[model samples]
Each structure stands twice: as structure tokens, then as C-alpha cells.
Target: MTETTAPAVGHQHDGPHGYASDKGAYLKRMRRIEGQVRGIARMIDEDVYCIDILTQVSAVTKALQAVSIGLVEDHLGHCVVDAARASEAEGAAKVKEAADAIGRLVRS
Candidate 1:
């Protein structure tokens, strides 16, 4: 893998919404995670060893968490920031609400 960094928000890397933008990297990550999930399902059907299946299950969990964190970052960098800049009254509240939701997800 190339040494990498996420380009600054709303720069050339930003897509239509200027926030929640995909540098295409995010989609690719999700696709890989999806494949991993399918593989896990197959392992179950094929009666794979419990330890091996659990290892892959762990990988799937981490991949999903990574995806969620990426979206949260994009939301903050683009959507939340834009709303704040435009002086939307509920902007911060929305971000807080989202953060709380994610917190619950993480705790689960």
C-alpha cells in the first residue's frame, strides 16, 4: 500500500456534497469488508474451526469500526463544519446527536 493521507476536506478530494465525500477509498474499504463478511458466512456453513472463524469475525468487527470512524470524520469535516459556518442553529446539536449515537454503537 502506498503511504497515504486523507486529503483536506472540500479540496479537490471532496465530492458533490463537499462533506460525506468519498475519495473512493472509503467505498473500496467497505467492499473489502463486505467480502470478509461473506467469507465469514461461508466459514460457518463449511463448519470451520471455532478459533479460525472467531479470528475472521474479529477482523470484520475492526473493519466495520474503521468504516464508521471514517464516516464520522467526514461528517465532522464537511457536514458539521458547513452547518456551523452557515450558522445553522441545530448544527452542533446534530453533530452531538450523531456522536452520541456512535457512542452507543461503540458500546454495544
Candidate 2:
């Protein structure tokens, strides 16, 4: 799998992001996921059964996927729509970027 990195310094978005309105909720969900991950580590450390560990892993994966899908929808609704209103070229660019992101998600 490809490894993604943070945006380059000083290259951050100029305006509020697509998920800006729901940022708090997103962070909450992420924290929950983090806890789940820590739980998984504890399970391994405690010699939990293989199946049970796998089950927890699957749950964590699904939670992450849900977050991803929500972000995608937000991007399409807010960023893509706003770009479309700004200009055809900008809209097309954002669409392509979003498509690439979706492709990565699907492959994952």
C-alpha cells in the first residue's frame, strides 16, 4: 500500500475545509478509534484468542471506513460544489482529486 504524507508546510488550504462544520464530531470519532486501537494492542499483550483479536480489528477497520465515507461525502457536497460554482476548470480539478481519493479508499 502507498503511504500518504501531510501537506507540505505553508501549503495548507486557504479556507475552511469540507469537514469544518463537523470537525468536532470527526475528532471524537477518531479518538474513539484510537482507543479501540489501544485496546487491540492490550488484547495482543494479554494473549487474547486469535479470533477475538481479529474481530476487534475488523470492527476498527469498519469504523475507519465509515469515517472515510463521511469525509468523502462532505468533500463532494461542500468542496466540489463550491468549486463547481467558482469555475468549470476548478470543479473538474476537484472532481479528479476526489476521484483519486476514492480510488485509493476502494483499493484499501
Candidate 3:
């Protein structure tokens, strides 16, 4: 059997799936990272030093990792915990999903 997932719609301003309270903070950090990306592109265009560009790239990677960690923590603390309270099977499924997500992040 094949299972399909539908893309989430109209959630930009509704906050993250897990972290509803810190939506503004997350958005601000993401915007800052977006600017950093633009700056890195400009640096490349202007023939900036390779090391400098690599350093910026590393910073962006770290920032994204931080965001990922935060989201995962929120998911486990809220979603997974809630599911655990509701049912053992559901809780196990949520835990497995969280583990898979963490594995992907680690591989990346």
C-alpha cells in the first residue's frame, strides 16, 4: 500500500508545527540567515576570498542546525509527549518518527 502526504498550507503566520510560542523569534533568525545567504552570494560575485566564503557557509550550516535542534526538541516535548499520554502505539510511532528525523539531520 502507498501512503501519500499533503503539503501543509497557510501556515506561514500560524507558527511552526511544534513551536507555537516562539514563532517570531524563529522567523527573525531565519530572516537573518536569509540575509547571510544573500551576502555570501554577493561575496562570491565580487570574487571574495574562498576561505571567507567557506566560513560564512559554515556559519549558515550551524545556524540551520540550531534551528533544527530547537524544532525537534519542541516536537518531542509537546507532540510526542502528548501522544504518549494518549496511547502507547501512537507514542511509539511519534518517537520513531522523531528518531528518523534526527538521523537525517545527523547524516546531513
Candidate 4:
């Protein structure tokens, strides 16, 4: 299945994103998760136990969720805050965008 991502916020700040400082760490975690996913595929090809594959799937899911949460936090701490400081309307729009993202996470 294909994955869909949220669109970028309309705020036009030229500075680095909130996650910039932690970009390396994020990349590392994602790479590890990518390895886990590959392992899962290998397991399936080898006909591993269903529960074992499911366990890996769960781990991958949690890893992705952790990343998602971190990104959301960064966005709030930086993007939303900056927008809020810029103007009330910009802040409200950011807040709504964040709420929509959170809602998608919760539903998923």
C-alpha cells in the first residue's frame, strides 16, 4: 500500500526546522527501522512463524509512531510557536494543522 504524508505548513520561515538539530538522530532511528523492515521481508520469504513476523511488524509500527510523535513535538515547539509569534491567524492555522495531524495519527 502507498503512504500519504501531510502537506507542508504555509509559514515561510527561512530558518532551520525544529528537527534540524536532531536530524542525525532521527535519521539513525529511521535507518534502524528500515533494517527491521527488511528483516521482516526476509522472514516472510523464509516462511517464519506468523507470530514472529507479527512481532516485528509491531516493532516497526511503534518505531514509526515514535518518529511521528517526535516530529509533531518538534513542529509544535518550533513551527507552531514561530507562527504564533508572527500572528494570531498564523498560529491558529498551525494549531488546526497540528490537530489534523494528531487526529490522523490517532485514527491510524
Judging by lDDT against the true structure, name the best candidate.
Answer: 4
Alpha carbon deviation, residue 91, candidate 1 (Å)? 2.5
The alpha-carbon lDDT assigned to residue 61 of candidate 3 equals 96
What tens digits encode model 3's per-residue C-alpha lDDT throughout 1-108?
A: 332452223221122367887888999999999999999999999999999999999999999999999999988887788768978976787788889999999999
Q: Please give, for residues 10-56, the per-residue lDDT of candidate 1 as tens digits.
A: 33223344323576888789889989999999999999999999999
* Candidate 2 segments exceeding 4 Å error: 1-12
Is candidate 1 or 3 superior in TM-score?
A: 3
TM-score per candidate: 0.73, 0.88, 0.84, 0.87
Compared with the true structure, model 4 gives a TM-score of 0.87
Question: Candidate 3, after superposition: displacement of residue 31 in Å?
Answer: 0.4
RMSD, one per candidate, in order: 9.2, 6.3, 6.0, 6.2
| Local distance difference test values of all predictions, in order | 0.72, 0.88, 0.82, 0.89
Q: Tell me the TM-score of model 3.
A: 0.84
Off by over 4 Å in 4: 1-12
How many clashing pairs per prediction, in order?
Answer: 0, 0, 0, 0
37: Cα error in model 2, Å: 0.2
The positional error of residue 54 in candidate 1, measured at the CA in angstroms, is: 0.7
Model 2 Cα shift for residue 61 (angstroms): 0.4
Descending-TM-score candidate ranking: 2, 4, 3, 1
Candidate 2, residue 86: the lDDT equals: 79
